[model samples]
Target: MEKIERGKALKTGRDYEDIKFRRKVFMSKCVKKAMSLFRIVTLIGISYIVLSPMISIISRAFFSESDVYNAMVYLIPQNGTLKNFKLAILRMDYWKTLGYSLLYIGSLAILQLFICSMVGYGFARFQFPFKKLLFGCVILTIVIPSYTIMLPLYMHFRNFDPLHLFGLLGIGAKNWLTTVKPVY
Candidate 1:
């Protein structure tokens, strides 16, 4: 049967199904577009949140001493200068310090990667005595604050001695605090 609307005849069976299918397709397209937009906006917001600190630090680096002291200035500097960078390099031996820091950090990173990889492999492939306890200890170390272990570390390095050899030789305890060993 055909239906007459606005002086136009509309097919009732196959045409009706075709119309419904087109509407559904159009609605699905709109929904997909909206979801894509929402995802893009969300990711952009997260990226900004993650990058804001680095942006703030980089902007602050251009500020002069006066600009730093001024309560009115925050992000935009009135008297921008590279004086801070120059002072850090010349007066504070920044290059030497940076090189040493990079070396120390790089070594530590490599060591950590190797050690963690081995431990992960062991956990994945093998079963050992105290396996659960060891895993729990590792997790506990990750969950707990490093500050809790600071006292013990300080005490150990405050007068570092081994096998009582230093005491036997009358050399006394050697303080490792002055070295970069404890800083890591």
Candidate 2:
């Protein structure tokens, strides 16, 4: 057996092997430390990105009108007030607005959840004609931007006529957008 000394050239095969093993371990430790540091930096950056808008909005909500206009006050308002919240509640008709919003959004979310689940289950379990085409159409809908279809949808709903059936029946086109029928 040969004794290995730090910062000294290897005198035997055993010493060389020992030095190589030590070098490998040292390199692995350095790499691990570097990776951990990198991970911490990346997490911090992501946290900042996600939280920055929320922090700004919360800070701004507390700011007075004058504080908002003042150039000296940036993130933290010099003087904070609840007047903004009071004004918002008054102007928005808090209870009625909240009720309507909850009714509309909650109904839509519940209906969408059930509808999507049923559709997904059908897709998974069924073997039907034109399934591929139907799936392709679904994919196409997902791929297409909502804004692209918004104009056509708006126009259709504004003067909703189904294949001129209303014209044949002598019933005039009803504006779906004007009525609350579309909400249901």
Candidate 3:
């Protein structure tokens, strides 16, 4: 029994000093491979868990009337049909809504493009006093959440509606949304 400064201590009468070292290396490699496989299995399991409900709902939507209830409950369908598609389209009023949405989106896009281009051009080209300050103020307004001003805006619209001010221009108060002929 003697203590050495550097190398591993050797036993007097055994032919297996390196056996433990070999076992440690083998175990570490196995553990690393196992962990990698475990991670891949976990990710696949999570994907299936997350997408199962969506897939089930879409499949159920195609099931026939008699099979729909069972399919929804069991997440399987023995029969399929297109009745859901017809009901969905009828409830949504697809064509009418599509036309109205297209018109609304077109007008909104044109107005936004014109206004943004004009504002951007002004900011880039103009040299009025306090221009940078005004730009900073506008940027601040954009960055700020609108919920802060929503109450104030609601109160202003309710109390000081511009439609009522049309009386000052000798126009009678009328439904502004229906007839938008300007009075100001």
**Tens digits of lDDT, candidate 1, 1-184:** 3443675655557877877888999999999999999999999999999999999899899998898899999889999999888887999898899999999999999999999999989998998999999999999989999999989988876988889789999999989788987665
Per-residue C-alpha lDDT of model 3 across residues 1-184, encoded as one tens digit per residue: 2443456665543325456666889999999999999999999999999999999888788888788556344565677678889998999998899999899999999999999899989999988999999899989989999999877765654434465576677775544333444332
Q: Which of 1 and 3 is ahead in lDDT?
A: 1
User: Tens digit of lDDT per residue, candidate 2, span 114-180?
Assistant: 9999999999999999999999999999999999988888886787889988878999887878788
The clash tally of candidate 2 reads 0
Candidate 3 ranges with C-alpha deviation above 4 Å: 1-82, 161-184
Q: State the displacement of the C-alpha of residue 136, model 1, in Å, after optimal TM-score superposition.
A: 9.0
CA lDDT scores, all candidates in order: 0.89, 0.90, 0.78
Error of 3 at 77 (Å): 7.3
Off by over 4 Å in 1: 1-7, 65-78, 127-184
Clashing pairs in 2: none
Which candidate should be chosen as best, given TM-score against the real structure? 2
TM-score of each: 0.60, 0.67, 0.47
Indicate whether candidate 1 or candidate 3 has the larger TM-score: 1
